[model samples]
Target chain A: MLAVLVGSGAMAQEIPAEPAIETAPEPEPIPEPPPVLHPPRNIVAQDVPHDNGGVLNIQWEPPIEGVPVRYVLEMAGEDGFFQEVTRTALTQYTVMQLENFVPYRFRVAAVYEKGQSMSPETEPVMARDHWLKLGEMPVLIAIFVFGSLLLFFIQAARRGVELFVRRISGLTAVEDAIGRATEMGKPVLYVPGTSTIEDVATLASLNILGEVARRTVHYDVKIICPNKDPIVYTIAREIVKETYASEGRPDAFDPDSVFFMVPDQFAFAAGVDGIMVREQPATIFLMGMFWAESLIMAETGASTGAIQIAGTDSVAQLPFFITACDYTLIGEELYAASAYLGREPMLLGTLKAQDYGKLVFLIIMVVFTLISVFSGYDAASLVRVR
Target chain B: MKRRFPMTIMFLFAIWGGISVFVGKTKVHDFDNLLRNKLLLIVGAFAIILGLGSLIFHHTQKIKRKARFWQYSYVTLIALAVTTFIGLGGGVRGERSLPTIFGGTVIGAHDGLVYVFTSQAEKNLFMDEPSRYADPTKAVLELPREFETDFNRFEASQLREEIHLKHTALQLKGQPIPPMISPVSNQQVAYKKEFKISLQQLYEGILVPCGSTMFAMLAFYMCSAAYRAFRMRNLHAGVLLVAAFIVMLGQIPLATAFIPGLHELRQWILDVPNLASKRGIMIGVGLGASATSFKIILGIERAWLGGGE
Candidate 1:
């Protein structure tokens, strides 16, 4: 019997066994439950108003049940693929610098601890430019009033109406200074400030330079003007040349008189100081905007014992000018210098308009103070720009 | 015509500038940006070229005429040339060398011994017992006969320090080896780009210090000016002197401590009276600037255009 069992085992080993038969084709495996997800709702995208365009205000509501860890905002592409814009904890976001005229769709997803679910996509919204900015109405009205006053005064001057302008001592001294330079046989040094042409102070200084150049020509006195900006140098050179030509002494205008020294502030100051020490000009005119170098240049001019006249709209530099200069045109006086020097009626009219604007400002200040005291209203806020 | 053309352009641009300030429209901003960024940038570039030409012409004329301080022009021109050459040729960051050779790494340990997988060429030499390579710069196989027997952590560290010292000496000479695998530590040893001097260093070391010195000179100038300005020649001078004294005294801790409520008093002066005067000046300046801008825009102020009516 053992030999027979061995023979059967040998036979089983020799032959390939058939496939085993199953009892109930194996019990089917249990399926996992679908994950519970909470998504944000009521996603909205609106065009931001009073903008240059390309801005949208996106807002969303949180999920109904549980609070989300955060929100994921997405913008849809042309292929309907959602690209993540930002992940934020807040419900609202401002998307800026989008294509102005292009329509955009947005979706928000509530990111929970377990999983995230997306909200219904918002309707297509397009950013558009508004005709006028409503927030700037106060500024617009103020500009209009000031402009009207200016026009009115200009017309009045054109009609030969007399205008009174206070004498600026600095401007009155300009001719005398040039005459002194002529007497001393020394050049008159003029610094037209260390600023670009874009600066209004530089423009004012240029206007004043024109008048100064004309006076220099009349006196036959040499003038030396140093500039820090290349554009200002060009303009100043032209003004000097043209002033000499108009005075019928074009040959007297030396092209090298008005020159660009340097662009760097302290470097220009050092150069100007060197020029002052070496040349020893009889009179120095410091005009336009100055910074820390104001004291440097002014002190150097003082050391040379020159009669220095300074004019600037820079409030900080005013003290330095007053300290080191014999005559100073403070604040608005610098702007009125051209009119004062030339005695032009139209220019004087503009000066009158500026004075009127100041009067209006004074009245507004008084009214605002009264309203604040009596009615507890923030009158300042009414004119406050956003 | 030359004057009229520029005046007309200026007038149109000035009006546009005013509108651009108040308008939030895209078209207005685009045009404004175009003028400010693109157009102005182009004009500025041309202006710089003209400025350089002017500088050259001025200096050359001064040198030819042997004007006062003509020798200084040579210094300026030479400095400009040298700076330009250094910036363009040597590069701003300065020169650098190739990386150093990689030494071996400690692979594993045998019975009372640590084995290192050395270089490929060295290993090949051991396997085949070939002749030395022709290149001397390549790392040499220096496996001593007594290496296995006399090897210790101390000798390995000493060797590493010796190599590091050599590299440091090279670095001080501005010839730094970039990076290499350290033999003893079995890690990378990196050396930063070391040079004698860089453009940025030159700017910081020379230019910045010069600027600071000039700025520092202002304090002395201010003191001198203050002495002259604060003299009691008149009522205005006395008022200025008193105000300056109070402000200066208020700034010092010892003075503030001695005088009670000195800080508050100073604050009141600054916040109320000083601020009121400053604001008044600012308002006047603003109105004047607006009026000037209006005159320029309306072509009423044409003196800026070369003494025109």
Candidate 2:
């Protein structure tokens, strides 16, 4: 059976004895090649003035064939050194950071990723550090307008300008709270919010603390001041000490009364609560940077039946203080509290300037809003030098 | 003369400082580091030490007097002594040897305490065959290597044997283990594991809430104080009370739920009138700050350095 199988396999191999030849048909020649892209013509380079230096604007037109092509902008110094600035699919580019007052030759080339066609160089253009003559106009106008208004207000105040500031209820309550404490023969608790001395709010609190100390001294009422920051603690101590000294009641100044509680926020709050509960001061003064503790401190003080007056610049905590404190200074009023109490001329002048600036800002805002509403946001109309 | 001389010097320095910063003449980066890092950091570190000393002294005085809860003083003292000893030991065995030892001990003790309480609690609560509880061997094994290092193996093995014995005895008695028992033990193990994981998370999360918990909790105490302290008993209080009420009710969801109109009113209060008032105050503050900054720059505000007193 194996021999028969072998014989059959050999016969199968010998069955296709005739040799075969095969051939492939040639492909048709490619169609005519596409036209080449040519370089742009009429290249122009202009110096952009009023800049530090080395800036130029180059523009050109595409060849008449109008085949879509990208433009290459290049610049070379007088020393025949060159660098490609940009390869834009547009006809223009602003070349910058060129050497000032130095001559430069620029050329434009039409380019595709595959190839580039160069244009003849434009006549050498010199970039100059041109100081724009009219550049100072806007600043000058601004200075003049502001300076005149400042001078005008100064003179008006000199002529006894009747500036009417709205009454802040928080400020009005300070005296009442202090008076209540004095009436009760209980100590007035003053806490310059949990911020360092460098914080404006802390300084403002210090100023108000001075005023409170003055009043407390006059009333022969005890005052307790607690601080969260060591630096603020020192400042508060100094302010209170100086105020007492100034009042000629240096003996009344109690160092123990003004103590540094834990610098930690909640720990400070807890300590303050302990103080409020233990001391049961008739009135509590809070001013400075406060957060969630505003409500905690205020609520605790409220529970103690201690009149609480709080001031802070933390917008998020203001609502909490407002709810929990008898009187709460919101936002910038904490800043104004110091000026209102101290009546420092520099502070007062700055306050007046701020008011003036705000008035100007309001007017500008109104005008801008009206113009935007009417003009439908035309780019040309909104453009201004300043 | 003492005050005036300092004031004069401060005023000049403040002005100089302000001009330098505003004119961009002073390198802001260098100045910021000097003020924030060098000055503030040194002062803050010393202040922290003072705070620690005060805490220790106050507690020590309480202990000496044998005041209420004075026994807690021993706990604090032991902790302090142990921490100092370990810290000063300088990791003679290895850098992390002491920490690993202490940390492991704490973790093991915590787990032991949980196990004891939970097991006893289950037993007292009439939990049948509580030992048949879901085995937490895998979870226990999964505990951090550091924790396992100080784990009380004897205690763990004893507890396991006790549980196994109880379980086998209950099974032999043909009594089914109570659902609550097994779940509670499983939960205890899960809780222990979760605690460790959460501690890891606390150290890893964007904020370490542990450090800030004391500060954040003050909000609660403050709220209590405010309610008791703030009352519209007088004229000034009346105005403050009204504003406070508006602001408070306006902030919560209750106001919107009760009176839809109040939401708009609140918005107006915040966006318009409130913003206007805030801006007005801010403008004043800005000017004040400018003047102060000017003074500081000119060296008039030397209070920052605790000088010029």
Candidate 3:
């Protein structure tokens, strides 16, 4: 019985030791020491000027060790303690607004989840406030060229130098259209367009109107103007009156013919259409800054069997005018038409100078296109060398 | 001589106004209060009278002569009388009250005009079925009764009807319903019609009709005008004819489709030779305009201001 009691006590002690052993299984195999991360390679630095004094640019390639790694770009000043600029998965970083003309040392380190490896510091790049230095030369060159051209033209115009101007088909047709109306014994309808007087297009229209008035006075043709702007209406009456007086036909001029239509665009268009349909004008002159109403007006004139001559600077709407009108002035040509018809010396000189400017533009475009084409072929090699 | 001196002064003022941009450094904020000042309000009030006067003079002449489409004059006269009566009869602190019947009528008409011409017109013309009203006659009959309830209630009910119609139409047309309400009104109202007509309405109702009519009318006028003007019995006319034919055919889609080369040719004409010529002309125009502007600024181009020789 004493022997049995001692065996029972030893068995209980062995059972407790077995429970402790079962609680802790083999420890995780020490996690394989996590693949060693090499530092980022070929670090480079450059100076960039910005509004503030706390930025720099750092660039580097991924580590050659072929491990997945991110980079941390760190910058330091003369104080020597590095502050992280950016933590990025990218190979490039632009450190911005660094202290002006101050030296900054930047380095990149490769990091894995386990640990980080250091890269060699890039050559110290100075932050500069001299940003204007880069852009100044090109801007100066452009200003000089543009200013000189402007001055030359102005001086030439002031000196009364004769400038050659090309004839616009639409302007040339103006007198003919008016004459045709005179022959048909029908009134001429002139719409200065639907834009407000503040628009430059309206000014061009007025200039053209002066020419049309001059012709109408000479031919003794009745000209009816339907205007959208009250200001334009007032101006039209004055212009027409002056033209008639200048042509020695002031008595023949009818102030009532210059009428003010509604201020609304569509209302004005409808009113003008009513005039076209009712009056059946032998000729219609649509000159000004027109919108979608251009096609409507042109088409209405076409239907009325009027000799339509439309001129506008709206490029998108030019196609409709071209299709419907006898002669259409495209874009800048409207401006040119007025100048040609007006025959003012200042205008002629400016026209000649602008032609030379356009020639310069054409040459530049051609050279740039050719260079772009040639450079595209070997761009990869050039990029590698850089 | 008295008129001439004041006119000259006004001309000088205008010239100064054009050059004010170069001379003055005033910020837009400085002008904001001045834009809404009492003097400007007075001037605008007078300007409105002038506008009404012009409209009256024009329609009166048409009415007197019994001109073509003279019947339209009645509509113009009635519109003018109603607008003038509303505008002139009402005042802020006068015999007429701020919320006078005339004033309210004017405001209601303006708002109603936009809704009818914009929303209802589209529903009437383009919609497959009237969605808001299962029966439009019922909605029409209810309109007068709702309007008689109270001014505010009437406006609210009318607005609701517009909303219902707009939403239902959009739903029927398989379009998403648009949320419509006055920004001043806090209520979030879903409209029956999705399309709110604006410039598109003007395009459809006015510009399209005018343009199509103008285009068709030109054909008849051109026939007569061409018979007289296009006698290509001269060198200049011959050149014009050729140029016209080239441009006309070049612009048409049918020509471009049939002859692929014509498209390139047209582009060349527009971009190269045409652009070059146009530029040459523009330079002249720019110079002329600059000179004219300079003259105006210096009070030389005084003809516009009705001054000078």
Candidate 4:
């Protein structure tokens, strides 16, 4: 502001000397200087919530008129260490890295033409870390609700409660896919996904493979599972061996049935395609997570006139499998296939609990939608996940 | 307890992973980085080494037994062995110390012979000129001269060094025959690498071609599958055929140019029904995965531990 006055004074030198009319020299009364703007109102400082600590937030309401050119905020703690944190036009400032346990005061001032006004120092506030963050309330609610429902269903099943789940045709045809291979005197090819065992989709595939192996052992059908991940291949071998043994067909289990191919994505796909072309299997089961290779395996199987059954959690690959395979279990159907096939109470009860959780989620969504329509408040915003 | 032990570890680790997300930009972030980048690599390295070992053992057994297609096993084994040796000996970037077999004769780069060189401008490479030379030969450059006559890099390098030295000196003295011209810039400099069989060369020449060939096969498969799938066997197949036709046509600018609103229709179809269905499947998949994870964490699912055993 002082710079603005000095700039105006320099411009006076550019003007021609006021003519002799200035000789009249009638001295005039000096105009009064402009009034200074008042400082902001209702200054408050509080601890920033839902954090690990060492932060405080300060807010103030600007005066209705005569606003300042800018606002300056400062903070002070023990030892009277007051220092300007930052200067900005915003009405609120968050002072960070304050001493965790020490109280701190904040002052906000407004700068005007030639003067400034400072608000009274805010009541000292201390930053503290809370054990639990309130920002995660929605997440906590979801977990608690879903987990409780799951536990409840598990207890109910332990008490001999019966559960009913509609049959998924894709799983029902697992026997047909295996039996066709047996009748045709060809091996049943099973690719338990090209991904590592760490992926949940691959784990889901393994669970279904167990049931398929048991059925194959009972029917005396040959089942060959090729894997791309070494750990998955080893565990698949174990699962097949145990399946045959438990079904009293130990001799039927072949260790070479579940083998590891090269770990390269396209290499695995080419190897599997070669297996499809050469072996000409009666049926191929492609399950788990796949990328670009999904269609390669499925289309090769289709061309060989083999019955292809594919199930994967990869949404992008689902279209390819649906286009080329005889039966493609879409999305959640793949995950649910294991429980549907085995019908074990442990699996069935979880499916039941998941249905209940979905119901609650549906109700919540419906309620939020209606509230937003009638009350004009976005209730769904309360459930922001991240 | 055999099953419970791994489950307990998984549960604790999952909980810690969840908690780490909320800590947000704190010291825990450093720990997360350490675990993800360092610890995971340590574990993955062992898994990969064991996997390679198994691959070697598997192929050798196939060869010993004379299994069907056993000849292909030899190819895989030889390729694996050669690549491993080359990768370990000739480093990924060819930085490993293997003795240079050929003389270090770089064709374009400075190799101790000089002739009149081109500076592209008068007097010097930069700044104002001292004086314009009527005959550029009077300047007498001290830099590497470009090979104006066609000379094979391999052939030239094999020639005796004295031949190039004697010829370069004569050319610098303004001899009418065998004119020496220098490259205008670095872009014009052409040099053959000293080592021919580099790791990157093998990867680009062999691995990339094979991978690309496999990926290219998808084009044929896609066409054949489309033929079978769009058979018009039912209403659903007919709908798919029509939708596929429009989407494919909309992708071509010529088709959309003939139909003014075709692009808008394509965008609406993608952004509306296609995205809606995709997101719907995503949500269902998410829920199923969540349920499955919970089952695994609570020990309700145990097939991963070798079935019911």
Candidate 5:
């Protein structure tokens, strides 16, 4: 048989018997499945505060021992079908951009290479819309206190209680400046700052501008208000027109005097500078929120030998104005100018209220400093506004 | 009616604005935004019209009376007209919708130059495939990196998504890369093409430089003003001069090295006196401004009503 097999193999190479394939050794015992993943504990889902809803803050405590697990956050809406929202190795997540008033149930699953272990589903947390934010408590308190004081003083003033506001030299010089303009037969350049009406400083300046306009109406000094904001230009035209009309010199109110120059800050400055160099108004009121242009305008007016009165709540620009302008209203003086100059009882009342508030604040500040210094009580920390 | 109507509206809106601050958990979810935003848009439209009217009237009067530097008004008016017309004619982005109904699904242009919108190749539409790399704020598009972008997450998410439809798979034999959305769908689609002029290009190229140039004139004005301001004549001026000089010197490391404790002095001035004064002013301004708001609301301040008209 061996000879036949050898002869067959020799005759045809394909005649060789197929070698018996060795039976595969029994596969090694299948490795024990990885230990069951430990689910996270203390899963809490809460609505985010001070938001317009649609946000949930989910937090969990990770199990100490896990099979190299990653946490998978799953959410189910009204559809009740849990969908994997995200995966993370974090203990907390702020889910954002959800629909308001939607009930969302969240579950966290510890997912390992072998299997997953899920925590019990959290109670459906409905995101409720909240209006007031707790962060603004200090602002609210300050406003309430300040507003009540103002109203109280105004009421007192209305009932013939005389309120005294300190004299501001800048405002007292208004008459002199306008008088000088009337004597020089030159225009009175009243700039209501480069800012719009949204700025309180601009509003304060506008109030002062109205008074200055009224004062100049009988004096016959042409008042030119170069406006940088169109709305302000329109409003200024009205104020000047009304002031002239009320003073029985309606024809003197030239609409073009309150024209708007370019809105660009520097361009407006340049335009006003050109006007200053050309017309050389005897008096200039550079008031309101001015930036770099404050110096340029004031210096140009000063170079023209005009009596320049600059005022602004912007402390950065105050130094420049004080250096260039003949009279500068620093900080609170700018706000106090309307009452000081116009002598309106309503405004004077507000000013007095502000002074009282300041006095109270100053006393508290000194007391707090003393406490913080000597007693180490940190009273400053308690009343810190922002 | 003119005064009362506005005052009523202002009072109501002011009250609304003030009260809206602390009502987040109420049933009025987004009521503040909806009402305020809508009203603002309407008023803004009217304000634009009024602004245009005032601008035209002012310029026309200037030209009629031949006011000083009246010739420059013509430049402004003409520029305004040209830019407004250009913006209107070409649209802000030069995007114009022309509807064309073509039968069949995604019949691309010759050489597969355009992609029909039948296959959701539109901007802002969700993609079937996920992105390669994801950031909270980065746009998902694989656009050319040369384009400048904003750091706004919402805007980035609203951009066109990258679709990797190979030209070979689409049987595009030979084509340039001007990916376009065709007008096969009912909704409007943008068909982009290379080398097209746009109004945005004009705005970015011309108007931006003009504005920048106008702003650039401030440096010269500042230098001139500073020269006039820094001169010493009085004690106050001397104090200011010394303070400014010290502050300026303290900023320079070489000067600080020579004058030991100069930087510390400057820091003390800035931290103690300067900050104290600033805080005092800020508190005053805050109270004053809030009082003004209350005054306006209560109708005690009528200066905005035109000299007590």
Candidate 6:
């Protein structure tokens, strides 16, 4: 029985071959060949205008025959092999990074799924650099007119011609603020803005600082100037030292007075605020390029009961300075402050030129507005800068 | 002559700047970019040396003199030293090593199994879920990428082979079944190959929070400024107050639900009057900046030359 069971098991384990069933294979569908496409026509390649050289603008009309998936832009040097520059679906493409003043030829290839056809090669063209950007003619003309007026006024002032000047209350208050600080026996805190020398506002603030330094020396008042930029720190130190020498009191210029605070924005604001709260300065000068921290510093100064005078060319910061400070220099007033205080003929002449420039700009705005309203034309395009 | 020499160079560069703006030449732009980027950056880098010297000198003097708040100077100096050391020695996210001891055990049988950990936090993390981090069949711990360091890193196949060999050896011993982690050995060699707290971590953990706190203070300051400026004292103040009120009201959904026209009124106020005034200031500022640049280039504004007329 055991042998019978073993034999049956072996028989069960033995593989049985099933009868093979034959079947016909389904017919495969043949793929149709892609239609031929013609290359673009009237291909024009020229140097881009009013830009640095080594760039060419290529444009073409669509092909008359079948459309292509994309057009391949190929370029070659005078004798170099053709290389694919770029592929574009549009009719126009800007070829860049070519050698200036070197003639090059370009061709367009209409690329299809199966095949591609090349357009006739364009004439050899060289990218030329323009000496003057003609697209900036409007700006150049305006600069010329304004600059000529400045030169004329500067020349006139150099000849000792008396020019009428207006009085700015903010400039007049500088002396009083210094006197107030002197009487209080507290230091005058001067923040020459939390910006680098690259900003003109900081330069203007430094210019104003020189005059303020001179006055502080004359009045025997202590001045605490904190800086945020390393370069500005060096310049401010020199200005203060020079101002002391010019005022015949070199000993009073403390080397540590014009110190550098942290260069961070909010950190500088917090440091200045801490100084305001601790030192309790009698007067604070917030001048230079300021962003969101303007209000924080100004309000802190206000809380300290310090006489604050803020000036900034940053239009967004003007409202903050105006609200928190006792005296605020608005818009162009900050730039005019140095001249207003110095009373130098050349500086005053430049200030007058700036006013004239504004007048001319106003007239231009009026004329443009009239043209836009009457002629229904966008005259802004004429002066629009690229 | 000291000032005149610098002014002469400044004059040349200024003229070059003005001319370069209108010259569409690649060489000119290249030179201009070189001066603006490379030259300025090199000088700025050197200036950092001067800044560090000044900072160190200022703090040293304060500590020597026992000046006001002199205790704070020590803190500043210590912080500076620590930050510099960490910044230079250990790069922002550079690695550091530490010893690690692996410990775990299965508590109960079936799917309700728990992992016995040395620390309570780790125990709670893997409680009643041994399969969450470790595979019973695989006999390997699946550590998160952030937690897995070079010393602890093991290839899956290699670790499985090692664990399998150990498991088979234990099984052949004919002893009672051992714990999941005990089978791998109590003290597995692991040298922590990465720092858990790096300079970047310090910056994000400390400086970022401080900066955020400072920035958050702006809201209070803005409120104070607005409250003071919006007082009904003069015509301008009244106008500002009303405009601010309208804008504030328009920003809220409840006010708009009451009067939909308030939104349009707010839009007109912002788009027309506010934008017009902003543009006026912008134009004035632009002209003023241009004039200042011209003056500086012409040497009419000599204050920037370190205080010479």
lDDT of 4 by residue, A1-386 (tens): 99999998998777776656435667898999877568888889998787667778889889666878888898888967778888989898888777677888888888777788888898888987655566777887887898888889888888889888877788888888888988998888899999887688998999889988888887787887887987787778888988887788888777667777788899899889988887788989999999999998898898899998999989899989999988888888887888888888878888887778778877987899999999999897899853
Highest DockQ model number: 1
- Kindly list the per-residue Cα lDDT of model 2 for residues A147-222, writing each as its tens digit: 4554565456557656555677988888888899889999999988887766877776776787888889889899
lDDT for residue B19 in candidate 4, whole number 0-100: 72
TM of each candidate vs. truth:
0.74, 0.56, 0.53, 0.73, 0.72, 0.77
lDDT of each: 0.79, 0.63, 0.62, 0.75, 0.73, 0.79
DockQ, per model, reads: 0.41, 0.10, 0.07, 0.29, 0.28, 0.39
Predicted structure with the largest TM-score when compared to the true one: 6
RMSD of each: 14.6, 14.1, 13.8, 11.7, 11.7, 12.3
Error of 5 at B212 (Å): 2.6
Candidate 6 CAPRI assessment class? acceptable
Residue-wise lDDT of candidate 6 within B98-151, one digit each (tens)?
222333332222232222332333334344353463533222343222222222
Off by over 4 Å in 2: A1-24, A28-165, A343-351, A376-386, B4-13, B20-36, B43-288, B291-309
Error of 4 at B17 (Å): 3.4
- Write one digit per residue (lDDT tens) for candidate 3, span A1-386: 98899988887775543454446676776656667778888888875442222445677888877664678889888787788988888999988756656778888888877789988777767765432333234334433464456557657877977666777788788878888999999999999988766566686677678778888887888898988877677677788887787777779988668877777666677788889999899999898888767766777788889999887766656656776789987666665565577676655554555566556656755666676688765432321311
User: Judged by TM-score relative to the true structure, which candidate is superior, 1 or 6?
Assistant: 6
**What would the TM-score be for candidate 6 when compared with the true structure?**
0.77
After superposition, candidate 6 runs with Cα above 4 Å error: A1-40, A62-128, B95-199, B253-258
**Between prediction 1 and prediction 4, which has the larger TM-score?**
1
Candidate 1, A1-386: lDDT as tens digits:
99999988988775677898867777688898866787888888999888677889998888888888999999974567789999999999999888888888999999988889989898888888876776777888888999999999989999999998777788899988989999999989999998889989989999899998888888888898988888888889899999888788989988888877778788889889988998899999999988899999999999999999999999999989988999999988888888888888988899899889999999999999999999999999999875
Residue-by-residue lDDT tens digits, candidate 4, B187-238: 2221222332346646766777899999999898888878888899999999
After aligning candidate 2 to the native by TM-score, how far in Å is the CA of A63 from where it should be? 14
Per-residue lDDT tens digits for candidate 2, residues B272-305, read 8778776766655554454444334434333333
